[model samples]
Target: MSSSVGPGDGSANRDAEFTETLKSVAGMANLTQSRQVIREIGSSVIQCAHDRTVSIIVARQVLDGLAGKLRSSGSDDTAEADAVVDIADYLLREINAQGQSSNLVDQTVGLCEVAATAFETKEEYTEAAQRLASIPLDESRRRVSPEDKVRVWIRIVRDYLEVDDSTAAEPYLNKAKGAIFDVNDAELNLHFKLSQARINDAKREFLAASASYHDISFSPKLAEEERLHTLTMAVRCAVLAPAGPSRARALGRLYKDERSVMLANDFSILEKMFLNRLLQPKEIKEFAETLQPHQLATTADGSTVLERAVIEHNLLGVSLVYNNIPIASLANLLGLSNDEAKTEAVAARMIEQGRLVGRIDQLKGMVWFEGGEASGQNGSGKTAAPVDKELRYWGANVQSLAEEVERVTAELQKQFPGFVEANLVV
Candidate 1:
């Protein structure tokens, strides 16, 4: 392989020169020559990777060049893809063969990061995150600064997020969260915020995610198109949030953001939410098409997240149009499968939980909308004193019923005393 002299290295010309040489050796068809390159890369080449930006760029290019070489060898089929991945694995194997805590410990840490970038380029996010996580950042082994820790943790978080592995990403997210306050880099801070928002969205903390995303959409660092895309994400998260007051505020904010009007498909639903208009099944189905698998994941009661959101939203809509509706009819409005009990249970739970801001009359089989907090279900998770309000209403109703019965009995005694006497103790 022909070598070029000092082609824009990440650090000193010597280190860059050495790395550029490894890139050439990586492309060689001979396996023996390729096998020997890992020692140089895992040691000298990697030890020089202090300039993270340039190091990542050059290292990623080296892996990309190898992948390109493998592809150029023959057919554009699955086997070629496998071969590309194999080359990356081969480098890791050779490095690990030398044992982990060699004199080149720093270089080993850097090499893992470099290898991870290659996996990420292939869209093998799980592997990429695993590669990055292999770095030992425990202060005992390596005393990494808070900023540095945040950098690596955020990278791992971003890769895990790509595969929707929020559970796995969580510990690292906490680690980053604790360390991020010390980080002053604008770009890194933005990345951390964005990652947190993604995790929230995946975990179905949609209202929090909506607020975070909307905040990000206003960042000056993003391009106009990117801002619009972020705004769209904010809308999606808000829509998925359980129907309640917090979600209402989120929706109201987005509705007022003139840019929301630019969202072609999402704008329709946003408009429905703003006006308390009922959403059609087809319209929700269309919006659901754009959701991630987790967004459609089923809840405890066997309904999907989208279905739950729609049911809650529709119930609020029904309350808006009717002062009181029968449980059976409410079930129809919510598109529940003739399960009046299920519908009643759902409505009652939302009301009692301080989500729906209304009440259900089980005996009369009716939903009575007080209509005070229409846009505000207080849903998703905001605490309010619901028990006191409900109990007060219940006490007032009991008193009112007694008064009406007494007044009716008085009229009966004055008009039909014999009939009243036959039925009453008095």
Candidate 2:
């Protein structure tokens, strides 16, 4: 009679074979061959698990075989899990070990799914997030650009927001803002703008949302779809702003223009409806600054007047020795003839008097005056009496210029206190 080996002995032999095969493949320097061998071993283990005829001993052998494959270079967690799903309890211990390893993302993610299906727990979801975070963000210009950093940040913010963790979300949103400007691609910029608008809208900061929309609308590099969406947001914000005189005018202007109408119809409907009411005085100021002088003049009323040209001559000699029109541009604006405009003549006289001392290259075609105060002498030094007169005249002119500037600045402050604060005059 021959001594026959038991099922446990055969299972142990198979397990030893699987382990030896895995060790051989892992030790090989050729990655491709090792992967092929691992796959073959994994398939055989999975087949054994599916065979019910195999005893618990055989099942253990199969699991051990799958785990050995997992340790191999080409072995993945999903494959390992699939091969041993029948023995989840046994697999759980192995899964935890794999999850803790640096090279176990595929296995961890697979384990997460299995764990979620088999056992629902808060830790599972947390583990899933952690495993997902571990995957290095693929760096590619076409697919996952640097601009996607903002999108990732925004997604994180939304997740945090869902948990009512606004404090945590705020930093993510701020990071998104900083990332948006760093992107070079125009298409990405439009996406960033839209994301910002959505975030602002969710925060109920409609004005900021509207401004973001406006930026998208006027973006020179944005795609057509992005531009349309941006215009829509602008129109919507305009309507949502207060319906005062300024808002009404802005809405009327936006509606009358072809670009505005195109944007109004294509962008969000809610934005269009609220566009007129969202207009801020600061927005109006920004818009006004971009317009030409003629455009601004055309919109002026009885209280408005064209701004006077900046005269760069001494105030004393301005009326007498020099012409009323100081420069060619000023002369043209004032509707004076070339001869009547003594800009050049006055400049020449100043040069002779040493009041305007500079290189001929600097004074080739224009008058360049230096202040008498900058000449390094007081009134009593040279040409004593005339110097005193010059000093007194300059002092009065400076005082007068200061008063005028102060008055204009005060008026600007009343009209736009926020603007004045941001742009304090030196």
Candidate 3:
């Protein structure tokens, strides 16, 4: 008649058994045995445990078991990819469960990382980033410091950039920057700047992006590969830049750098061809044939950078030798077919972009270069008045300054809305 176990003791024994089962699952080496044990415990039992740490350990064990099976199989089966998706779903559920556990931030973040990596393996970059970004926005979180919160936000911005969706990336980038505003982490700063550069690039602001890349390329904190990649991007941006003093300076900086030689070998034949075109405009055609489709200027729609560079060089060459040239002849100099409308269209773009300091005469079918100032024909012909030229230049400067001020104001508002509004109120 000795012992009927008390209700409290019976509950305590079950809790201990559940905790021991978790430890056993974590330590299990035999994949088959681990799977069997998890099946025995069942989802209902595990969910009822309501212990975030136990959920994390079980999820990690399952992921490891799946990976071990794949490694041993030696052949990738479609079934394996499906298995990965299932595991990612499980991890996602675990993360949701842990949202209100203040002590489980690292485990929750780690589970999200695993899920993201799995999605990335399937080339679902946007989904991968979204999974991480969702953590910060979770309403159930017991506590998350802004600094800790930004860690996942940074990952979201990066993954969006991987898919070239800067429009979608913008909101997350803004969120990440706000969270890290008062934190002084060098790595986060670099990541933020890199995202900004990429966003500028996606927006087709090549000059500003080039400046950003150039600055990052010189950061002493960058790893070797990162520095090289940043420098390579800087060169690409410079080459794609519309013709101007800024483009000239960007090219000059690249040519003067010794690292440009390494870029020719490590990056692409495209780089070498581009460099040759810039330094010796005559070589544009010879190297132009080597450019692949991706080397094209993206904004120009299937037009290769080398082709545009050739047209630009021909324009510069003619400006030195002739006060004015027929549009057809200029097209011929650049090896363009004799299409009057097409040639004039190309010339018009260059002129409009200020790459060619000239005006296109459609009625005359000729382009005049700065009234022969470019050809030094002013010594042999007429010239615009120096006073008029100076005034026009200053007017352009005033317009440019106004545009830059407006851009800065918009950026400040985005980056520091509260401060901006407070200042405005004051």
Candidate 4:
């Protein structure tokens, strides 16, 4: 009972015990273990392949285990494919050892998913598209489900849109359209329409494009905020459509309904110009004389404040005598500087406004007011002063001034008889 083992005996016994434990565990477990265990084993297998005979068997086990894990995960197919690619180089090395072409084919075709995973990482969409295209349709139909195909097409379309080559993208667009229409899902349909709208815009088919744009406006599948954007595109297309007169009319009606003061004034000015060009000189003169005296005043001061009025009236008279020479040239005759001439011209504009005249025109060098009234003043009974001596001295002769004013007044009355009574005189 007092027996004691030596150091060598104790070492031998420990070795025996360790060997037995290894044997039991090795027999109890399958060739491949859990995913975590398999991953570790796969790493070891890669390391062992550098120098050990068990490398091929270990790599095979790792691949089988990883494939099983991928199948069970049911979601993360891409990640699963990526895991397979991690082992591809080792697998290829072993397959090369076999010296069989069929072995190479079997290995490559078996890991199509892995190839896809690696190809996608290249970020060359054209290459990915080519690889995907090379996979037998039947094999893809069996291996990747319809839902996966839809996802793939979505990715392809996104990539194609980035490239922005309409010719190269047409087939992808067609494929996406088919996938969208074939699927009965409302969400997918809306996505399809959105893509179609983009493609249609690229193709320059605005009418067909608008239809797709309109679909997204009320699509329940799209977010409310996104639907607003879609609605905007539809409205834009409707406004820009070149084919339909109805659309043009509708836009015109909307604009007219929303008329602002600025827009209304522009229209009024334009209409008066059109009518002025259409009417004869006698009619134009009649229209000018019909204006109230105060309407023609340069300032709001009473009619007797004659200097500003004379300056204004004489400016008009100079325009008539000099064939409506610009105010800058008239300024030169009056010995005023450019800025002074511009100021004088602007003052003349104020007088025209007071008279409710639309515009001043120089016909054959003589200036005439297009929509001027006879009284030449506003409702306050103010009248412009007679032609100033200074103005007459500056190349504006009395005879020419009187004749021009008379002629313009006659034209105004001829065009509008009662217009002068209604708007011009007190």
For candidate 3, give the lDDT.
Answer: 0.60
Sort by lDDT, best first. 1, 3, 4, 2
User: Can you write out model 2's per-residue Cα lDDT over 174-224, one digit (the tens) per residue?
Assistant: 766766777776666565566666566445454566567776777778778
List TM-score per model, in order. Answer: 0.71, 0.31, 0.65, 0.35
Best by lDDT: 1
Off by over 4 Å in 2: 1-101, 104-151, 154-171, 178-182, 219-226, 242-257, 263-426
lDDT, candidate 2, residue 236? 51
| Cα-based lDDT at residue 386, candidate 2 | 31
Candidate 1: where is the Cα deviation over 4 Å?
Answer: 1-33, 36-102, 139-143, 374-426
* Candidate 4 global CA lDDT score: 0.44
TM-score of predicted model 3?
Answer: 0.65
Tens-place lDDT per residue, model 3, 1-426, is 212233454444554566556556556544333444444443433343353323444444443443334234322343444444454456446435644234344444554565566566677789888777755445465466676667667778889888878888989878877777776788878888899888877766767887889889988898889898898787666656555455666677776777767776323433443343423444444444433344454445345664565455455556666777887887776666776656666655555454556665555667777742222222222234222233346768989999998899899999999989989653
Query: How well does candidate 4 score on lDDT at residue 289?
Result: 49
In Å, residue 388's CA in model 2 sits off its true spot by 55
Provide the lDDT at 249 for model 2: 49
Regarding lDDT, does 1 or 4 come out ahead? 1
Of the two candidates 3 and 4, the one with more favorable TM-score, higher being better, is: 3
